[model samples]
Target: MFEQLGLIGCGLMGGSFALALKRAGLVKRVVGYSKSPSTTERARQMGVIDVEAPSALLAVSGADIVLLAVPVAATEATLKAIRHLVSKDMLIMDVGSTKRDVIDAGRRVLRDHVGSFVPCHPIAGKEVSGVENADVDLYVGKQVIVTPIDRTQPEQLQRAVDVWQKLQCNVVQMAPEAHDAAFAAVSHLPHLIAFALVNGIASQTRAEDFLTLAGPGFRDFTRIAASEPKMWRDILLANRQELLEQSQVFQRTLKAMEAMIEAGNADALEGFITQASQLRANWRMGPKKG
Candidate 1:
């Protein structure tokens, strides 16, 4: 699909992209760069990329497609470092969880090149990090949300969609603001609650003992708490307004449940439980393989 592909930050996301493209024969060459020497070396040893660049600029140079797989906080800095080197023909895209900030940063640094940059968020990941955990099929059948601004070129948007389709992803397009707001409720707010639940429990007496008795439900609910803190922190801050609103809604729901339990309102509690159960059941019916 492309002559050469560049990946900036070869951690889980970038490394996985490289693996996917090569596995699908979508690219002839993949050049990757990461700040950590060990990560770059690991990616090289794993055959995730044909070449490893020493800097972000070198990695993106002469490439038809470039992916910024760094944290939301580092997106702007990475874009600035490679803005001048990025060829006009290159299709630049970011896999950051948040979109508005990254899209704005692209507009500022990339200027007219903004049309080439597509802000995308792949709603798929593992708790594990590094090149070792990278899988070629990581994005297969996953939903990839592409946020294109008014400045985005039609051809560039089509190219971005085509690339994700090649990776076997279900591609969907949305406005950057809408993407942020929706994800704030579904993704960011859930992560926050998981972290808070784990921390709150840890503060209680016999916390370690309580953990030993916890079941699959507790384990599943708090699994996201194990994700990289710095990355999640950046995502939360970047989408703070949407996240805060979601958090408030969550807080209200929690308070209502607590009040129902305290007042021994069986009917109200049952109604809440039924609604939650139905929502979860419906979610399970979405795009899952047997």
Candidate 2:
């Protein structure tokens, strides 16, 4: 077990990591810090953290493992804050949604200690935020993507992977840029589309009237729109380049459907809808039998 875990950002992601570590008995104690005092206090009360640190540096002090679970935009400043406390033997990782920007921040702030940094993104979370909603099983069975940089220490990278493995996470490795690009399509773009669709309807003068008659499909599609706004805003902007590309691809599909509906082309519309339905149905069915 790691002697101590230094967790920065005591929000949902960070809080959940600490709980997972504790539940797995992989970490002896957790020292946590958040810019918001209330969050740190809440985390301590919730037992997500064993110690509440007043500053980021203090949080990492005497800790062998450090996790920065702050937003992608705050990576630079947060890393700069705790860089001095980082050591060669320490394992530093982040649960940021976008990796390239975070890896860039690590390069800028981590400097000599960059080898200890392993950029990670756990493909798990809910529509809610904060320590109050943190789940101990958040990472269990989730895809924990580790994007290692050239300067990453091989042993340290494996140690980071092991930590997640012990938590029952399915660890995967990829380049930082590729992680950013892939997640932008699957995770980031969906959130953006959800927000856009919800807002588009809400922007109409009769939005409230329409929403009152909305059903399960609308509720399921727009559930993500209720997610923390500032977090999604940061995610979209950080991965804007990749997200823009994904958005264009989605727009093309949308245009094709739009044209089919406009022309009342029954055969073409059926084909268009059928393809998507078949793909989604197959995915729901999981792997094919041998």
Candidate 3:
């Protein structure tokens, strides 16, 4: 069990993580900090954190494990804030959706202490955000992608895996670049499409009329469009190159289907639909448990 968990960013992701660790008896105390004083205060009042730190560095003052749940854009500044207190034995991890940029920030800010930092991306969260929406079951049975660089310490990596496993999370390791590329296609691109789809429809003349006719399929497909704008904005920009590459592939496939429909080629359309149906039917999410 960790003596103390220094949680930076007391929002949905960090609050939920602190709650999870507390529930699993993995950490004895949680010291949380947020950019907003009100957020840190609320997290403390809600029992998500045992103490509210005035600054990021103080949050990690005596902690053995630290979690940076801030946006990918703020990673470098956050690392710089707490770098002095970060030690070789400490296991520092981030829940940034994109790993390549986060790893780059760690290298630049943490320097020789970078080995203590383990880049992590937990494939879990809701469209809703904030400390009030934090749930202890957030990480339960979820797939957490840990992207470790060459400088990462083996002991620190094991500690990170152990912490997640204790929280009932399925731990998977990958190179930072590979993790970004894979998630761009699976996670990032989908959110981008969802955001764009909603905006595209809203910009049309009959936007209200179109929404009134939306069915369950449309609701489900556009669900991610409700995600926090600032968080998604950072994610989209951070993984833009990979996301754009995935978007191009998606556009080509869409154009192919459009061409078939325009030509009245039912056979080709059915073939394309069948391929996608099979692919989706074979996919499964990580097991979830209470």
Which candidate number would show the highest lDDT if scored against the true structure? 3
Candidate 3 lDDT trough over 10 residues, lowest sum? 281-290
lDDT of 3 by residue, 99-180 (tens): 9999989999999999999999999999899999999999997899999989999999999999999999999998988999
Which tens-of-lDDT digit does each residue in 1-290 have in candidate 1? 88888899999999999899898888999899999977888899999988989999999888999999999999989999998887567899989999999988998989988988988999889998888999888999899999999988889899999989988898989899999999999899999989999999999999999999999999899999999988999999999999999999989989999999999999999999999999888786134556
The regions of model 2 sitting more than 4 angstroms off are: 284-290
Q: lDDT value for candidate 2?
A: 0.91
lDDT per residue (tens digit) for residues 1-290 in model 2: 89999999999899999999998889999999999998899999999999999999999999999999998898999998988889999999999899988888888888888999999988899988899999998888888899998899999999999999999987889998898888888788999999889889989999999999999999998888899988888999999999999999999999989999999999999998899998888773211346
Better of 1 and 3 by lDDT: 3
Each candidate's TM vs. the true structure? 0.96, 0.96, 0.97
| Model 1 alpha-carbon miss at residue 152, Å | 0.7
Q: What lDDT does the true structure give each of the candidates? A: 0.91, 0.91, 0.94
Model 3 TM-score?
Answer: 0.97
RMSD (Å) of each candidate, 1 decimal: 1.9, 1.7, 2.1
* Number of clashes found in candidate 2: 0
